[model samples]
Target chain A: NETAKAELGRATWKLMHTMTLRYPENPTQDHRDALESYFYLTSRLYPCGECAAEFQQLLKKFPPQTSSRRAASLWLCSVHNEVNARLKKPAFDCANLDATYDCGC
Target chain B: NETAKAELGRATWKLMHTMTLRYPENPTQDHRDALESYFYLTSRLYPCGECAAEFQQLLKKFPPQTSSRRAASLWLCSVHNEVNARLKKPAFDCANLDATYDCGC
Candidate 1:
């Protein structure tokens, strides 16, 4: 169960980071709203209740950054590091994020 | 890139399947709406353009089944098999669904 939870986290993070990386550089208000709402909805519906609660608290503490692709991705990386810190996991180097999540789409 | 894409797909499927598995047995309308909207948003915001398009088409062909947890999971499995068929990947036995996604939450 712990393994499955961890795997779910990894997958959710991958999808989110990739999403921000692909977010339009010059987004319309609609795009920004979609991104923000997506995060809230995700936190609300995430399968893991504890993680979802943690994520909701994270959102309250550090609301989603939706200004641009770089802003959003870095924001997510930092938030992920927050979760990692809580889990006593090693931090990811944020500078290397661009190189890390190429979707090849 | 393809590797990243494939990994993303696997992760997404895992999260989604687990989500349906944990869904309320007698969900309220709000829960069903959230699930349906989540899929739409996922298709709309999926990082991969081609896959997103295909997913959109799939949603049109076979809309999300939100009547019950079992209904949703099986519908998703069938849809996943459809994708696997197109990719020439081996089909997963839907009967083994419960055994596959145990998210020790």
Candidate 2:
């Protein structure tokens, strides 16, 4: 069902996004099962502004993150945004307290 | 030699903690070069209340985070606090704009 896809997308996205900042390089395939399950949801879904924005933010916040991690975060941020957008809810903010994000750039 | 360990500890601590929130499983072998390089520093260093506090906060904030990630966040937070405390700076806040953290809890 479409609803199932939507729910699965949301769940995986959340997991991926949350893992990214913590395991950036690669989650050592720890989440392969979850990733495999969500393949359909990810493929069915299209990219939107929120996902795009999160991709941009992830790039800004974790420049050294692995491709898998980036993709996961981007995917989650998009779906997270999609559902929230429907409800007209506000965007999520994880603003760092530091002036600089400590990118070591 | 001791000072070098401290510097290494600080750098790796930052890397590990950031990754923990993003990739809560394992950071793969990509950062192994750095992690192995800093093993001596991490082992040589002792935990203080600051590190202990950060560890507690990490547990609170990233309930789904892995032990390794939690340890890294805790170490970074501890050292981060120690440095910030020395400078008399404010706490770092990555507050979400939403009332709920959306942990889906």
Compute the interface RMSD for each candidate structure: 1.1, 15.8
| Model 1 residue B27 CA deviation in Å | 0.8
Ten residues in sequence with the least summed lDDT for candidate 1 chain A: A1-10
Write the residue-wise lDDT of candidate 1 on B1-105 in tens digits.
688889889878888898888888888999999888888888888899999999999999999999899999999999999999999999999999989887878
Q: Per-residue lDDT of B1-105 in model 2, one digit per residue for the tens? A: 344334433443333333333333455554433333232222222123244354445445543222454454454455455556655876554332112122221
What are the DockQ scores of the candidates, in order? 0.77, 0.02
- Give the Cα error of residue A85 in candidate 2, in Å: 0.6
- TM agreement with the true structure for every prediction: 0.95, 0.24
**Candidate 1 lDDT:** 0.90
Tell me how candidate 2 scores on lDDT.
0.39
What lDDT does each candidate get? 0.90, 0.39
Q: Estimate the Cα RMSD of every predicted model relative to the unseen true structure.
A: 1.2, 15.2
Q: Please report, as a residue range, the 10-residue window in candidate 1 chain B with the lowest summed lDDT.
A: B1-10
- DockQ of prediction 2: 0.02
Off by over 4 Å in 2: A1-16, A27-33, A38-67, A93-105, B1-105
* Candidate 1 colliding pairs: A1-B104
